[model samples]
Target chain A: PRMKLVLVDHNEFAQAVAGADEAEIIEVIDHHRLSGNLRTKEPIRFINEPVGSTSTIVGIMYRMREAAPDKSTAICLCAGIISDTLHLTSPTTTSTDKEILEWLAGIGGIDSAQFVKDFFAAGSMLREHTPDRALESDRKVFEENGWHISISQIEELGLEEFWKRETELQGALQALLTKHSLHFACLMVTDITRHHSVLLVAGDQRVIDAIDYPQAKEHVYDMAGVVSRKKQLFPYMSHVVTKLDAP
Target chain B: PRMKLVLVDHNEFAQAVAGADEAEIIEVIDHHRLSGNLRTKEPIRFINEPVGSTSTIVGIMYRMREAAPDKSTAICLCAGIISDTLHLTSPTTTSTDKEILEWLAGIGGIDSAQFVKDFFAAGSMLREHTPDRALESDRKVFEENGWHISISQIEELGLEEFWKRETELQGALQALLTKHSLHFACLMVTDITRHHSVLLVAGDQRVIDAIDYPQAKEHVYDMAGVVSRKKQLFPYMSHVVTKLDAP
Candidate 1:
């Protein structure tokens, strides 16, 4: 059986899926806040980093598996990490990422200047994706404090495309909430390269309004230097949850 | 549930396990040998490197986890890796190990000279175990061509003790062959600090006799500067395996 991607925040799900027959579980590359339960009986290869994206995780895996990462895998992983983390611009970018990036640039045959131009161009494909598609494409689901919430990372073409996608992103977020039966949904319309997250929260206005953050424009919250969901968003979200639950 | 050890070649497992359960796997530290199957389901703050021992793996984990490794754990891990890989003496030792050892030495509250003394002393417990136990403790299982083989390593004990333990080590090795159901077992007794492996083989005599290494001694094989498994033993073994399989 071939391997499939099992994106998880909890260990049991990972374990169950990994333990299942027909699941080769050949590789487990992840970047998230930690949760122990990564044990699998399969002869699997894994790469985990504290950086912003699984792309960085895959980059390291490619190097370890092949002793040298193939060009395509290297570029894809590098591009994934850059887009996910918003370059090294994300606050979540660690010394490890810096180290890995340097190594990746050497291995992946990347020209930093050229990569930046191509990367933004790929992410800035605003016309191709609906706001909902953009929001849903990179989403993670988890149960927080009692309510099940979904967080989506929405990146678009810089200032020019931001206003264009704003309404669509908002509608997409609402659609996702109803479709998924989520208590609430948060879309971080972020310019990772710019190191800022324009957080859009909807569904339960009570949940949205109850959370505290720097107001960008009323209900929209703006967080500076917030490129990584694991490092930056999760902690702030936890704080927001605490505030909402305050007696 | 408490976190169990989940060993991998990377950091993602460590972080994921840490998040899944409140039972923190606590420590993760590994030398990057690309062997072993370890599983975990709790945040196991781990440190893995292209080093020589899981002991060093734990030391780095200590630095990251509690922001400090206590005296015993620090000493144990330091000694473990040093003893396992002969104190960054092996060719397999990565620059990460060199860098981390330097950091660990400072943080673990010990000097380099003292660490070497303590680690070697603990590892060179030649008085405690028979030749076989000493030989088998640092064993690696490798499959080359069509045969499965086990390689055991021993390092830096006086000639007197090595000879004294030879008979016992041989007997223990015979038992290991039966226990593991291996095709063959090879012991590389190396004076890592001095650079040599007293190559000992058990199983098919044809396999042993077929090896045409110039320095090989009678009754007991002696190869000077054969300390690294990757650089030395692996090549020799691969060659020997090819010779044995040649029709």
Candidate 2:
């Protein structure tokens, strides 16, 4: 018997569940930039949409199947949509996302505005984590061309707060570089109020030189008006590094 | 005022509808291999699916909107699905296509078996046309790497009948190559009964030479068990052409 797999939220072997390479992927429902040259011996259902959240695509899949999600499932998907789109303020939010959120919110019979406010209040506790814990939270690794890179993003209320932790954060990033055998590791500390970010890096010198962005210090660079890491930071640096002569 | 466009079945500036270059595209719904780097100033609804027919994706769109197609539209979409998938037997047909076809067939009150028999019988009327008309009936142009090529597929009852018209068909293919400024052009004469095809070629002898199959003539080769030009012939040759050193 063949082991069958169905991936939700994420695709790509490097980011998928453990033992994914040994299983046959039956379907993938995701809301991310399609990456990795995944080949299978059989055809698979791959639904990747440019939306705010994977939850939005999953909602659509449920609707297409003519099955209403359970109460808890609907609320969970609603939270995912709200979190990923940042209360509908992120540029990554799409009209379809807005529509699905409305449907899910109505099904859950909850005030989404109140829920989002509470969600933000809870997310602002980033000050509690040490630099290492902060880096481990919401971390993702990607392979751009042949360069394997890890990028993590965290939101802070104030730029000064992150700058104070710079030395400790840089140490965590360097540790990640060694642990993952990565060509590069980047951490984006975005100020929620100002909609600007400062990126800290630790990687191969060649990878650092390819950024196109002016570094504020030896390993930190300012990125203005960039809030979404997947949409902005990863794509920007990935294009630059792949165009460079070598990693 | 600005021109707004909605492209159906096809995308890509090179192969888009004429006057598309002068207009701003607002949406693209297609079912072919996704190609071209199309970007816009604003977000648009771009739906590209791995279904057998553009009609299959369109059918899902109609279903998602909760609006049923009229009888004529239902029949039309059903015919498209049946034709493109060769009655759900083509390699390109997906489970989604089968689902859409069944729904459309039910709505249109069609006996799919009878419809498919009539469809293929109608498709095998290539001998009634002059070679020029036959070539123009189902011509499609593609861009691979930097090279542009046109391919036409026709269903015939026998290989000998198509061989008799080879000179005249080659003339038509050469005209298409000159008119479209294509790097190459190919005509696939498929035997509907025997499930074999003889591919005739024009322009860019390097591309023809690159086909792994042994050539039966200067520009003709035997292709056994090959149907679905988009899935089989175009992809196979595109891989070869793109892998070559240069055009």
| Displacement of the residue A178 alpha carbon in candidate 1, Å | 1.9
Per residue, candidate 2 scores C-alpha lDDT tens digits across A19-44 of: 88788776767766654334442234
User: Residue B141 in model 1: shift from native, Å?
Assistant: 28
The CAPRI-style docking tier of model 2 reads incorrect
Which structure among the candidates has the greatest TM-score?
2
Runs of candidate 1 with Cα error greater than 4 angstroms are A1-27, A37-47, A52-66, A123-125, A242-247, B1-27, B30-53, B56-247
lDDT of 1 by residue, B1-247 (tens): 6554444433333123344334334444443332332333212333444456655555554554436776666655566556655778776666656766776666668787876876566646456776656765667766556667788876665555666677777777778889978778877777755776687678767677776655444447878666876556766776787667632
Docking class of 1: incorrect
Clashing pairs in 2: none
In the range B1-247, model 2's lDDT, one tens digit per residue, is 5688887776656667677778877676776654433544223455667689989988998998798788789999999998787778777888999999999998998898898778777744456887778988887887777888888998765777787788888898898888888889999888867878889999987887788777888788989889878778877877878887667
**Candidate 2 chain A, poorest ten consecutive residues by summed lDDT:** A35-44
Q: Given candidate 1, what's the lDDT at residue A70?
A: 70
Q: Give the Cα lDDT of each candidate.
A: 0.61, 0.79
lDDT of 2: 0.79
